[model samples]
Target: MHDSTQSRRTARNSLLIMVCTLLSRLLGIIKARVLGSVFGATAIADVINFTFNIPNNFRKLFAEGAVNAALIPAFSSLLGRNEKHRCVRLFALLCTFQSLLLIPLVLVSYFYGDGLIAFLSDFDANQVRLGGRLLPFFMVYLATISLASIFNGVLQAHENFLHAYLSPLLFSICVIFGVWFLSDRYGAMSMAYSVLGGGLLQGSYSYLMVRRYEYRFKPMLRPQNAPFKEVLVAWALVSLGMGMQIITQMVSFLFASHLSEGSVTAFTNSTIFYQTPYGIFFNAISAVSLPLMSRAAASNNAPLLRTYTRNSLLSLLALLLPSSIILFFLSRESVSVVLQTGNYTLADATLTALVLRPYLVFMVFSAWYALMLRLGYSANRHALMTRIVFLQNLLDIALMWVFLKLGLDIVSLPLANGIAYTLGLFILFFLLRDLFPLTKEARFFKGLLRIVLANLPVLAFCIFYKNLGLQWHESGSSFANLAYLMLIGSAALGIMLLSYKIARIPLLSLLRSKKHGGNLQGDNLIHLD
Candidate 1:
């Protein structure tokens, strides 16, 4: 009874987070459109995008709940034994240490950001100088976001998710406003200033949220405690895993830079399109699952852990499969409609869509890799996760290098990423096989087959949708492009609904879920817990 009730709460929280994430993702598109409209795919655009990518990558390791994942286990462990005061102190101490470490890092990046920019890209001296100057603003962004993550971690550990989820939305809003109002004068530099304000506001909001609790900001530095030691180790391991990704992305930037004048923008923007699907589905699942899975792991609750894992996997595929297909088919149209306005030309949008095709493949497998990676954190299998991640990252880098040597030109960037994600998904899945035990194989595959069947027709429709007298060709107007995509989307929706009906899938059971039922072995519809 208790477990079922908790599951209900979890579902509610996940839904709430999903809605919040959807808002943030939309706001992000606005930011992208604003930036793209102002600078198009020029060097200034590349420089701005690349500069943000630096601190953005750094911030992601902290932002995407690695801090929460690390801290949750420690907090869970301590609270399991009734040591609440220590949890508070440890939170304070960890925050103190994070700030201390961030200061010097920020100083270095701020002072020599141009040199760092030059080292990372093939930009000429002037563009390098421009990127360098902007790096300081984003570095400040890194600090603010990094600091915000600690508070987010604490709030999430307490299972207070609303404020933690809102920080990103708030940050995006600030960035959009700053860029819109200040851009004419500050130009690209306005983005930097906006980032500064956004980060500060984001950090402040989280701090205020945390203040409502008994957690302190006294700046304690007692790292020798056993609880603190466990947290430090967990955080270190998590950082190591994230560090591999950070390196992989930086190398990707290097490869993209050499490809062409605007390759960096295309490469990065294509990946940005990826955020739509991930945020709408996988992000919510992972956010809600991670802390729950951590608790389940700590208490050795195998049944509960199995349920979360299976449902999360089902939810992701059920959502991502069709979503990836539609985007894959409409890649050019999607990019064109979303970004090809103002200064951003159709040629630039076309280049980005081509880059997006491979990323769609990467994005699908990436969902699995990410979910399993969290499972690794839940199980505290950091060393194993570390190895798996590094292996994948190294393979990706090597493949990128080989592709360049093979004279594949710009294809090397996304091709290497796609291969790495495909291989990494298999590797992680194999390593985490115990979570999806063989006894459940019959049900898992059945549910998976049903999901596949439901999407097969949608895939077919996407393949030849333009052939049915749909005037989806270029019309030189953004409204026309958007309307065509909308029509296609509406038609696709009808196909999926009919397909679901034909498959006898219960569409509402998952949404109005009253209890956690079934698993990966369900016969028709996916049964969400």
Candidate 2:
């Protein structure tokens, strides 16, 4: 009975988290629009992007991917054991240690900002110098936000969803306000300070909310005998794996930096836009699956773990397959509607649309690989995950080089990403063959193939429709162009749905499935043990 109640609570918390994430994405679009209008696809935006990537990468390494991956499972286990005091102590230690560490990291990044920017940025002399100037301020921004992420993760693990959800909203508020008030007077540099101020506000906001939960912070290095050390070490190792998965991001960024003054900004904006659907589907699956996987592992229910893993994989494919198609067809319209504003001209929109078309192809593959990695981690197959990460990274770099050599240009980066993800998925399957029967594996692949085949008609129709839409009168208004494309695109999507029904594919299987509460209610899932 207690287990049933606990499961209900987890489900509720997961729902809250998902809602918050969706809100963040919405705010993210708004913020991007504001920045796009103000800065456009110019050198100033490029410098801001370059400066921001430094801390953003670090955050992914520690706060989002690494720390949260380690903390949630370990913390869940600790809490499962009823060791509440120890859990609180662990949070305090991390908060304290990170606070001290961030100070130095921020200082170093700021003081040596110019040199670092010059080294990392492959750009014209003027752009490089400007990027370097933006680095110190952005470094401060990254540092504070990264620290805030720690608290956010803590709140997430505790299943305190509200505070965690609001943190990013707070960030977006500060940024919009800062840009609105200061961008005019101080120009591009003021945006940097706005980012820093937003970061501070976000961090303080999270910290205060955390205090309300009775998790007080203290500054001490007492090796508090707990799983903190083990988890930290494990997280570091896992981050190496996660970091490798994105090795192509760094490579592509470096290569793109060499292209032109505005190339980096264009690429970054393209990435952000493409990431929206990825985040919606990928994050949704991972959020629900990880805790379930951890629970299954803790209870020693291998079969249930396998079942959950399979469901999560299918859910990802079901979403990504269609999303990739939509992205390919609507790339231009999406860019115009979401990003084309103010300083962002038609040319900038066209460029971003061009790059985004190929970038979303790996959505399904990467989502599946990410699920496999988490499943492996939950089952304590850390070594397997580590090796996969290493190989995936190696493959990414090799593919990036091949694409460049072949003159594939900007699209090659995502193409490399797609190749790596494809390889990773197969490797994960082979490694988990015992858990997933050979026949079942065949069925999964068949289902995925059917989904792709099912969407082909829709893709073809959209291609034809888009050509026609482009021909209909040339209105200089971005909105008019977008509306026409969307009208045509909607018709295409409608046809796609009809085709899915004719093909007898479960087109909305994911949506039809039980959502948050459904995972815990009126189901035999709990008895799978």
Candidate 3:
């Protein structure tokens, strides 16, 4: 009975997380549409993407990866032990430390922004100058991201993921609003500046929610506490993990520099398209899984941990694999429709699609690797995960060079990433098996087989439907094209759901949740006492 209740709670919490993430991604899609409509992937759009990458890279390094990885697990441990005040103090110290660290970095990036752009982008003098002019404004955006990240970690620590999960909508809104209203007035730079303002707003909104939940921030350092020390260790591990991505970015930039004149822009645009699906589904699932995984580990519940991990991974695979197949088939057309407007030429769209084809293949593996790493973190094996991350980066670098030397050219960049992630997934699978041998429930594998079998027909139908839609769009009226697309997409989704039902997978279990049903297993979703 207790286990049933716990599982019920877990399901409810998971549902809530999905709801917020869905809302956030919906806004993100709308935001992308606005950007597409207004700027139409012009050189100006290139400037925005390129310039913002400077600060945004830092945001990922410090805020998204390292800070969250280190902060959440450490805070959870302290909170679990009832060291409440110490946890608060740790937050204050880290906040101060982060502020101090970012100030100098942001200023340096701001002042020498042009030089950095020149060095990294390897673009012509004029492009470098324009990128520099736009980079400083991104400092504000980076700062906003940093603060918001901290608040998000705090929320997750308390198992209050709703606000943190939903806050991204505000960012999407700011960008869409800025482009819609200010694009004509302030031109391209105004859109970038609006992003800056949006960042500030997002940070403030998150902080207010944290305060409302009775969490306060102070400007001080107290690094001597036990929790602080743990955070320091976790930080070291996550820093290593975060460096993998930075290295990948550097490799990508190098390839971008040597490619044709607009190759950099082409790569950036296509990457954004690939990232949309990734951000909407993969990232959201991983984010929700982290805290839940941590809680399961804290309580040493092996069965529940395995169940959650497998379920999350299965969900990722069930969606990502089919999406990847569909995207591969439609890559060129999708790229053209989304980005081939105004100054963005057919050549740019073609190259972007060419690169996207291989790059998106990594999505499934990347999502799986992310979940595995989080599982490692939950198990308090940061040291092992750190080593794995270091090796993964080394492999990525090596693969990138090998691909270049083999004359695979620019397309090799994404291929290298895809290969690296495939390797990472294998290693992760072994580690997971070794770490929780008992939790490798055979039922999970059976369920996976069922899902795969059910998906075969669905994939075939989707491809056929997509082809028909494309043919109609080419010859039919605009309304007819629209109708065809809507019909196909809706049909595909409906078929997938129907397949889940027929296969007897738990896809619809959450929808049928009853008050007395408790959890599907003795799982605790939020784990907030």
The candidate maximizing lDDT is 1
lDDT by residue for model 1 (1-529), tens: 6645655566676677778988987887788778778778898889998888888777766655568668766675566456778878888888788788888878998788878988999999989988988998888888888888888877776767788898879899998889889989988899889999999999999999988878777777666554777677878777887888888888889888888787898888888897777767776777777776777777777766766676677667777788888888888788877777766777888788888887776676788788888888888887788788889899999999999999877778888977987898788877788865735556556766888888999989987874565435344347777787888888887888788777765443332122344543333244444
Least accurate 10 contiguous residues by lDDT in model 3 = 520-529
TM-score: which candidate is best? 1
lDDT of 2 by residue, 1-529 (tens): 5545654564455456557777888887778878888888898888887678777877777677777677776666666566778878888778777777677877776677667777887777777777666776776776677667777766766667668767878888888878878888988877887888888898899989878767787875775666668777777788887687567577789988877566777788888877877886677567656656766676676666665666567657756777788777777677777666667776787878777776777777788888888877776677678888898878878888889889887766777877888898889878967655535555356555666777888778867866665633223346677677678668877877787676665433332222221332222222111
TM-score of 3: 0.81
Report the number of backbone clashes for model 3: 8
lDDT of 2 at 50: 68
Worst 10 residues of 1 by lDDT: 507-516
What residue runs in model 1 are displaced by over 4 Å at the alpha carbon?
1-7, 33-54, 61-65, 76-83, 106-138, 182-193, 223-226, 258-265, 341-351, 401-409, 438-440, 464-471, 501-529
lDDT scores of the candidates, listed in order: 0.77, 0.71, 0.72
Q: How accurate is candidate 2 locally (lDDT)?
A: 0.71
> Which 10-residue window of candidate 2 scores lowest in summed lDDT?
520-529
Q: After superposition, how far is residue 435 of candidate 3 from its true place, in Å?
A: 2.6
Model 1, residue 308: displacement in angstroms? 1.0
